[model samples]
Target: MSKNSTLILEVKNLAKKFGDYVAVDGISFDIKESEILGFLGPNGAGKSTTINCILGLIKPEVGTIRIFGKDLFKKRSEIMQEVNYCSAESNLPWSLTVNECLRAYSALYAVKNASTKIDELLERFEIAEFKNKRMRNLSFGQRARASLCKALLNDPKLLLLDEPMASMDPDVVDRGIKLLLKIQKETGMSVLYTSHNMWEIEQVASKVVFVNHGKVMAQGTALELTRQEVQLEAKEPDLREVFIQLSRKAPEMEEK
Candidate 1:
């Protein structure tokens, strides 16, 4: 999507703290319709905290979150209807079968023809064969795929994915990314994707937001961030290197 695309999510000056420890400090970013924004940062950079704030799972002590141009805290129930999130950390009931878990979510979303939607998603993820398998019986990668299926059951306008492919094999990760891009293109859905795989981000994200020490350190296309780090000598921009360089800096450097 372009800059002209309707803004799907806007976060301004968000801050949250645990006593004297700041988990997220003055973080801000926006996601436009059909845009896949790569939310990049090292561990403890508050990327997850920022996402949690947007989901309204944790209220921020400062700032506002707007989804679809409405206050997230005020219209959260309404806004959540058009939003969904997926992460490796999100767990399904272990006793339930994969299909059972998906059915539960489809019902929650009030999806019409839930059976058909579940079937399609299972097929898309190549997990139809494991539909009846208990969630606990599935491998890490299989469970991740199942979580993804549940996330899309609502055909969400805004999807938040935090390391959704962290445990998947390379082949599955590739397939998952391709399917995600295809769906986003056809549905104009916006995605806030977080992953440590810089190559994967380069492949899918239309824009990049880099956070450090709970603040936005940079925001731009991957190429732009790469260029800011090093002069390109007729070579391709390397986002991984950019990540490395920024991640290695001392916390004091972020104040500059």
Candidate 2:
């Protein structure tokens, strides 16, 4: 792909299955460089399964995942060197100090000038004071910051974030969002982020993919999706409204 093409991550007909259950039913999408793509869906709507397929963490029953025009599974090492992920449930070693964990991740990613990068991230996230604190001693917000720092340790070209703002205070979430925007601007990294918070997604995502029943029900800019709903004469058309219209099991009664 040419630099001007902008496509950074591409998924074509991706599907995943566990015995008789299909988690992702041949979903496809692409994320472009310097773009923050939001993956939105209800619980068990295959968001996580799709992410796992993109990361090559689980083998999909069908379809292809390409990073920078290279097959993700065939070129795992090359793909991984330029990609990273952060998720809410991912844990740090409880016995390791914050600094140590960062260093360990830096080593794993073979980041040059690892110590300098770790120090810079520590200061950037305002966690320098807790650098020597054990992982078990850090609050949930602090751990989230640390996870983000680790994900960016190698300065990846593609960053996958699953609820990056979870467990963060309002102040911390503000800081984190700013830091994420700054990083994307500086490094030109493409981000594929999943979130349940419609407000947060509206704030950060340039485009969105809405999934339901293991398939993409809608894909467009957030504003486009909202407007589409309004054109359909749906009551109080908004992202949440569209989400409910598409995925809600029962018709939601509009409050008087």
Instruction: Give the top-scoring candidate (lDDT).
Output: 1
User: Which residue runs does candidate 1 get wrong by more than 4 Å?
Assistant: 232-235, 250-256
Over 50-95, each residue of candidate 1 has an lDDT whose tens digit, in order, gives 9999999999999999999999999999999889999987588999
When summed lDDT is taken over every stretch of 10 residues in candidate 1, the lowest stretch is 247-256
RMSD values for the candidates in order, in angstroms, are 1.8, 5.1
Global lDDT of model 2: 0.84
Per-residue CA lDDT of model 2 for 1-256, tens digit only, reads 1155578999999888888887888789998878899899898989988988888889998999999989998998888989999998757798999999999998889999998999999999889999999999999998989889888999999999998778889888887888888888888888998887776777678889988767887899776887785455434336776677667643233332
RMSD of 1: 1.8
TM-score of each: 0.96, 0.91
lDDT of candidates 1 onward, in order? 0.90, 0.84
* Model 1 lDDT, residue 224, Cα: 86
lDDT, candidate 1, residue 183? 89
Ten residues in sequence with the least summed lDDT for candidate 2? 247-256
